[model samples]
Target: METLSLLADGFSVALTPSNLFLAVVGCILGTVIGALPGLGPSNGVAILIPLAFSLGLDATAALVLMTAVYYGAMYGGRISSILLNIPGDEPALMTTLDGYPMAKAGRASDALVLSGVASFVGAFLATIGLILLAPMLARIAFLFGPAEYFALYLLAFSTLGGIASNNQAKAAIAACIGLGISMIGLDNNTGIARLTMGELHLMDGVDFLVAIVGLFAVTEVFVFIESHGKNSALGVKLGKITIPVKDILRCKWTMLRSTFIGFIAGVLPGAGASLGSFMAYSAEKSLVRDNSQFGKGDVRGVAAPEAGNNAAAGGALVPMLTLGVPGSGTTAVLLALLMTLNITPGPTLFTDRPDVVWGLIASLLIANVVLLLLNVPMVRLFVHILSVPPWVLLPGVTMISFVGIFSLSGSTFDLLLMIGFGAMGFFLRKLDVPTVPIILGILLGNNMEDSLRRAMVISGGEWTYLFSSGIAIGLWVAAVLGFVAPMFLRGKIRKPQAITD
Candidate 1:
């Protein structure tokens, strides 16, 4: 009953004229960004962060806009997957398995509509789950001490590498890089400059907003330049957009099951939508007696992954909101946004900032409905986004990054630093290094350090004190298992080839 009351209060905030307008704009922009292959939700949100700040949106308003974009991008990823056999992001990779085949079979419209519905189902149900689960999880988190928190942060870093990168070693290197960068500012305890290297601006440390823009937004511009701004897709032609009711009914159970699976996967720190999509599709395949049609245009194939990944997207928010651990790479980005807003997300967040927490949850519910309604009729509009030439789009993105970053601190040095990070990110991508872990490390390093220091101080510097509590030991064990499980899981998962026809 209290949850319901809070949700009602959240709806009041979400329904405000300005907030609703931002949500609509964010959804449309997110869909367009999602339709463009390779941009993904992280980049979309990163690019828009400056705009949110420039507009001086309050905490609740800003969060609402970004989370709406997050959900919208999840819906939009399927557009490219179905039409061009290209994934809009990592999580959408599975959608191409069956979505493109359906398009090739002259069911492009059906595929788009069905996938949209499935996305709606997954996201909607997942939001409901978040409402029920996050509070309980937050309550549980209230029991964590410094040692347990330190162990939990370690677990996040450990598990993150497995799902975020193909090679754990590369992920570790990225994390070290992030930790090194995070150490640039003055030490909070002693007020001593650590990595300033004599530059005054360095004393405050590198702003995460700058790094995020450089790594996620500006790096894409360089990547586009390297690719010579080419659009080579032989796009699919859409017929009349129509809902496939029969197919929706056929896949009802699949959507429900995939939602459950994806939500669980999303809640697990570091196991994100990519795993959720894969697990949902693989599970559906295994459950079916006649599974030969899975990669060859089966409607169930389209529904499972669409539902699964979207659910995972919602699920990823739980840990970010309740425990300050991002469940996915995108949620890591969102975590940065929260910290920048001077809002610390943890168990106290519910009591201290009920408006922000419940308001975000309410906005998500609205965004899901808004996305479902907008996606079907605007299918043609979003599909046209795929046709936008990179030459036209790349410059706009570059301008936004430049303007947005400058608006934040009005610092030319930060701009240069952003470009430097962009170049570094470009090289890192070339080296098959994941940037998400680096961001995660940077985001959590200070907190992790503080936790460790506090734990040691409390335990009189005894190392065994790290393992003194059951929660601490459990987290340590989970960290070890989280790091190792992905290696074996990756080998067992069969990746379906995208249809290139």
Candidate 2:
């Protein structure tokens, strides 16, 4: 009841004409990008942040718009997965295991509608989870001190590198690179440049937008070009978009189970949409009546993965908003936007700025509705995005990144730096090292360092300060377990669909 009252208050702000309009626009744009190969939610959200700032809207409005885009992209990713056998992003990969087969069997409309409805159900439930759980989580975080916070951040870094990638060594290296990059600017403790190399531009450290633009948007362009541009997607004739009432009834349990599974995965420190969706698909495959049809046009396959991934997307926001720890790459970008806007997200965020927190929650619900409406009836139009030639799409994306990054700093040097990171990103992506943990490293690196310094100062440089408190010791144990447990879980989990094209 208390949550309901607060949510009603949130609706008052979210329903303002301007805010509603932004939500609609974000959904449309997100769908367009999600339909396109190589442009996932993270890329879509990252590139749009700079433009969102230029819109002159207040921070709440901008966050609402960006988060709406995130949800829309999750909803839209299924379009290409079902129609073209191409996942729009990594999280959508599991959809293709059965979605494309359903399309091939002349059930394209069914596949799209089922996935669309599942996405809605998942996001709706996850938002409720967010409403109930975020405050509790934030309250718990209030007890953390500098030492506890450092250990917590270390746990985040460890889990990200340990689990998000197949090879922990590569993930660690990527994180180290990002941490090293974060140290390029002057050391606040000593008032001396550490790795600036005397370049004035390096004194400020790399802008998060520049890194995100280069790593996701620019690297994606290069990857698309390497694949010899876009090819034609398989066409499946559309029937009525509506699912039969019988089918909906049958899927009730699948949707509910996947929602819970996905939400739990999303709330974990490093598990994200991709993992959630994959786990849900695996569970559905095991429990469904027709296990024989698990990957061969199984509607449950489409329904479960779509629901789980969308739910996970919402769940991921819990840590980002309440604890200032992003569980995935997309949320990492959102965190960067908050920092850029001088909005520090933590326990105090909800208490200090209830409007932003509640308003965002309300807007996310509205965006889910918008995405469902857009996807169900107009999916045929979205599928047409596959027909767009790569030459046209790639250039537009590249131009957008270049223009946005330059606008942020007004420096050609930043452009060069972006290109440099683009090259590094391209090469690193070739190794499948997972660039997300690197961004996480960069985002949390300074804070982690500051916490360490603060704890040491309080302890008179005694190294024992690192383990001064029970919470701090617990966090250290968790960090070590985060790194060690993955080795045991690696091959035990079902492999996700790795389909790209």
Candidate 3:
């Protein structure tokens, strides 16, 4: 009854004319951007933060628009991957295994339709999962004390190294850098700074937007340049988008199975759409056993990844909305936007900002529908994104990122900081360090430190206070296992990899 009540309210807010229009625009933009070679939802959202702000929309409106983009990109990714061997985005990588082959075999229309429908199914179900699960998780989080929170944060940190990547050490190093940077501002007990380095501007600490834009947008630009990337999408011929009824029936179970798999993966620490899609594809391949046409145009292959990734997109939102931990880069950027709006994303997010959480959920549901409608009719148009020259595209993106950071601070100082971060991101990524964890570190570091101090102050500075509660101990044990298990299973677990090269 309560869930229904909340859904009713969410629909009321999300159905507003303005919000509906933003959702449509975001879906269109998202699909186009996702069709691009290097840009994904993370880049789209990161680049739009400033544009959204410049337009001066409220937190709810701005976030809903961006969230719509996030969902739309998931659907759009299949367009490029199915037609062109090039994956539109990271999660779409698995789609190419069968998608391109199907296109080559003159079933491109079927591949596109099936993947699109599967994506809708997964996203729709995942949103349902979010509706049901997020509330329970948030309620559980409400019982957490400072110690529990600290241990939880530690667990989150420990698992992050394994997130979209398998390199725990690189993730930890990046996290440490984030923690170190977050300490730049004045301390609570003493006004003295931790890492200001004698600069007056450092007293405010590193801006999250600045860090996000640089690490995600600017860094992507640099990497693209270093590689001298060219448009690689080869055109595919298509007549009408249609799927055979038999194929839909065949993949019915596959879609259902992958939806759950992807949603669960998305809920896990560090695992994101890429992992979700890959794991789902692998599961289908293994389960179908010897008869699978997995690498050679299996309908199940296309269905699994599209559904899994879309579902994972929804699942990824759970931790971010309920626990302030982001499961993927896009969610990390989303988290940054939430904090930028001065909204804390823990349990109180439900009670304190029902409009935001519920509205976003409702919007995602609409985004899926919008994306489906847009995907089939606009498939041909989306392919054009692959043809846009790098020179034209890169400069446009740079201008957007620059304008976003500029609008925020109204100063060149953050711009320089952004470029510096951009360089740092490029080099760190070059060395195989995951930058998302660092962003997570900076985002969570302040809250973590505060929780630690609160626990200490409550215990009169007792060292044992951190380990006093069973919940805290359990969380610590999980953290330990999370960090240590990887070492023992080093050879067993897959090596660290980015979803996109």
What are the per-residue Cα lDDT tens digits for candidate 2 across 1-501? 877888998999999999999999999889888778788899999888888877677998998888888898888888888887888888999999999998889888888988898999999999999999999998988998889888888887888777777878888898888887887798878888888888998898888788888899999888877987855454435776676566667788899899999998898878889988988999888887669988898778888999999889989999988989898888999999999788999999989998899999999989988988898888777877777777888889999988888777789999998898888999999997879887888888888899999999999999998998898899899899888888888777533647554
Clashing pairs in 3: 163-270
What are the candidates' C-alpha RMSDs?
A: 1.7, 1.6, 1.9
Per-residue lDDT over 241-317 for candidate 1, one digit per residue giving the tens place of the 0 to 100 score: 88899999999999999999999989998888888898899999999888999999999999999999999999999
Per-residue alpha-carbon lDDT of candidate 3 for residues 1-501, written as tens digits (9 for 90 to 100): 998888889989899999999999999998888888778888778888777877988988888899998998888888878787888788888898889899889998888888888999999999999999999999998888999999888887787775445678888898899887888888866677877779888888888888888888888789879877664554546777665678878999999999999999898767788878987887888888564577889999899999999999999999889988888888988888888787889999999999988998998889888998888756767766777766678778988899888988897889999999999999997898888788888888888899999999999999799999888899999888878787777665553243342
TM-score, every prediction: 0.97, 0.97, 0.96
Ranking by lDDT: 1, 2, 3
lDDT of each: 0.89, 0.86, 0.85
Which regions of candidate 2 fall more than 4 Å away from where they truly are?
Answer: 230-236, 494-497
In model 3, the Cα lDDT at residue 381 comes to 74
Q: Which candidate ranks first by lDDT, i.e. highest?
A: 1
